[model samples]
Target: MLRKIIHVDMDAFYASVEQLDFPELIGKPIAVGGDGARGVVAAASYEARKFGVRSAISGVQAKKNCPGLIFVKPRFERYKEISTQIRRIFYDYTDLVEPLALDEAFLDVSNNKIGCPSATLIAYEIRQRIYQELGLTASAGISINKFLAKIASDYNKPNGQKTIEPQEVEEFLEELEIKKFFGIGKKTADRMYHHGIFTGKDLKSKSIEFLIENFGKAGAEYYNLVRGIQDSPVRPNRTIKSLGTERTFDENLSSEIFLLEKLDGLVQELSLRLKKSNVSGKTVTLKIKYRDFVQQTRSKTLPYFMSDSELILDVVKGLLFQEELKDSVRLIGVTISSLNTEIKKLPFVIQLEFDF
Candidate 1:
């Protein structure tokens, strides 16, 4: 049986949330990030996107793109509150909801609580409910599987929906641009283009053996994707693999003393995150990025799991001085892996407050 999958993505989530709370920001080009020299945009409102402003770009560049662009500091706790509300709505229909981020998720409604057979209708209702309850708009794509559904969601974005019937999957993919396919990044698309693979049809023409020889293990994945054969399930409780935090300085720091000061703060933030998640790990990795953009990492595995700030800081300090400074540092990060968490299963219970 073809599994019914729906991928719902919030329209400019962070920026929209800011606009919703601050009436003056509505319809204005706003970015959810710092406006400082070293600040990067976490999200950009649709109005800001019109001016070529986008997420991950420097705040300076965003301002250059649109002089009227407004920058608001991120309120992560508020975003999480809204995200929880959204997930409650998803659980109303199905327990098989896989959240990719705070803004997007994949729902497996082939066997749903409401016994709704039409995935498209379920998606429409979900989007409507979100708008009605939270004043936030969402876009959705409905199809036979996760990959196609995710791709289709982007077809009609920002408060819209699309459906790709199982029968239409073949023709739709054939005409789809290779770069638009899920899991294919810009670099990979460029490599495919060099081999004259411009569209799904072109990708389908290559033999699996030829694909494997050129692209390694990913070649087989491409072959199956072009054939509409993705079978990954929508897992509601995804295991937490690792937790981390990082900081990028406005000015590069060359002194070891300054680097230690920065590490102190990072360790504290990471510890809070670990405690909130209720997980600890045995491995701590320190990441260093120099002013020239070259990156390096130093890792140490402890005999026991730890999440305390002091323990993490001790490991980071040792790593920081383990090697001499290659150049002035611009960014530093701490990551804890090899977690004690094996399988985290969140209890699935429908929220009763929502009428629908």
Candidate 2:
């Protein structure tokens, strides 16, 4: 039986949320992230993108590109609350829901509860429900498999939906830029560019052996992917590997005293979250993102499981200060894992205030 998959992605999720909650931000270029010279754009409103502002770009550059752009610090707690509401909408249709992140997911509705067989119809309903219930808009892609669905969803974004029937899959893939193919990152695309492989058609012309010779094991995977041969199942109840939170600073910090101050705040948040879920762990992790977007993590395992904020803060402080200052730090986060505790995801609640 041909599987029916729907990929749903929230358009500029963080920025859109900002716009939804703040009417003044609509139609204005805004970004949700740090506002400091060394800060990075977490998400950009569509308006901001018009001026070339985008996620991962430095806040300084974004300002230079769009002087009128508004920068708002990220409110992760509010975003998480909204994400839960969106997930509930997905579960109403199918139990086979695989979340890619807080703002995107794949739903396998081949055997959905709706009794209606058209996945495209389900996509429409899901989008409609999200906008009506949460005052948010989502774009959806419907296809026979996840890869095509994910691609199709992005074709018409920010409150739109697309369906790629099985018969149309090959033609669709052939016309795409090589970069759009899953697993082909900037580096791989550069290599493909050097080799004169520029599109799906270019990739398809190469032999599996040649791809393997050039790109090794990943080449084999890419060869199959280009042929539209992905068989990865939509894993709904995938195990929660870890529960952690991190914050991006408005400004990159070179001062050890300032970095420790930020680290302490992160520890407090992580500790509260752990306690809320009644979860504790033996492994504590410290993540650091440099001003240039290079990220690294340092982790240590303790002899006993502990969720005490003071202890977590001490561990993080050691991990962070043990080494000399590298580049200015742009972000810091702390996490504890290995508890095998169940994750706490808030259920979606209908907002009666939203009228659609």
Candidate 3:
């Protein structure tokens, strides 16, 4: 039997929630993030996007794009409260719910608790409840597999839904751009474009061997992806691999004095999370996103597993100053894994949320 998958994505989640809570901010250009010269945009409202304001861009740039843009800080606790409400609604239909982030999730309804034979109806009902109960709008995509469902969900904007029937898979993929396919990033797409593989139809014309030759290990996977043969299952009780928080700077920083100073507050945040979850690890990973958005990670595994924030900070400092950066950094994040604490089966783990 085909896996009836539904992908639910919220519309401009964080910014919309702000608008809902503060009526005066409605219909205005606003963003959620620090407004300082050293801060980066966390989320942007639809109105702000018109002026070229985007997440991860510096606040200075965002303001330059829209002089009247209002900046607000992120409130993850409040967003988590609303996300729980959304999950309760999903549980009414099926337990096969896999949350991708705080604002979007995938649901398998092939054998749903509600016994709804039509995936379209289930998606419609889910969207209506979110708006009526939470004062939020959601877009849904329904299909026979997870990959197709995710693409379909983005077809309409704000509060719309779309579904792809089994029979329409071939025609649907043929017309889609290679960039739009899941797992195909900008770097890969650029390489494919150079080879004249611009769309699904162009990809379909190539033999599997030819694709493997160009893409290496990913070639076999791409061969199946273009034909819409995705069979990855929806994982409800997904294990938490690692937990971390990150900060984006308004300006790229390359100096060690400034970078080390930034680590103090970052360590404090990581400490809080470690204490809250009661997890200790020997592996500490440091992540850096450069000016051009290229990211790199360096990690260290200590002899003992400890959740000491100061110790983690000490290790990362060595990694950072050990090598000169190729470019100034726009963002920094830290994570600890290989944990000694118990692994809990969780329905979801909050990640960076976005409408796209």
Highest lDDT: which candidate?
1
* Candidate 1 segments exceeding 4 Å error: 243-297, 300-321, 324-342, 345-356
Model 3 C-alpha lDDT per residue in residues 114-233, reported as the tens digit of each score: 867888999999999999999999999998889999999989977999999988999999899999998898779999999999999999988999999999989998889789898777
lDDT of 1 at 158: 90
Candidate 1 residue-wise lDDT, 124-157, digit = tens: 9999999999999999998878899999999899
Q: What is the lDDT of residue 52 in candidate 1?
A: 95
Q: How does residue 265 of candidate 1 score in lDDT?
A: 63
Q: What would the TM-score be for candidate 3 when compared with the true structure?
A: 0.78
What lDDT does model 1 reach?
0.87
Candidate 2 vs 3: which has more TM-score: 3
Instruction: Give all candidates' CA lDDT scores.
Output: 0.87, 0.81, 0.84
TM-score of 1: 0.77
Every model's TM-score: 0.77, 0.73, 0.78
The window of 10 residues in a row where model 3 has the poorest summed lDDT is 347-356
lDDT, candidate 2, 1-356, per-residue tens: 46888999998888999999999999999987666744667789999999999876667788999999999977767888899899998999988898876788999888778777788888999999999999888999987778888888988887999998877878888889998876677778999999889999998899999999999999998888777787777877555556687877878998889988767656755664564344678899989889999888999999998877789888888898778767998888887998755656544322111101
Cα lDDT, model 3, residue 308: 65
- Quickly count the clashes in candidate 1: 0
Please give the ranking of all candidate structures by lDDT, highest first, separated by commas: 1, 3, 2
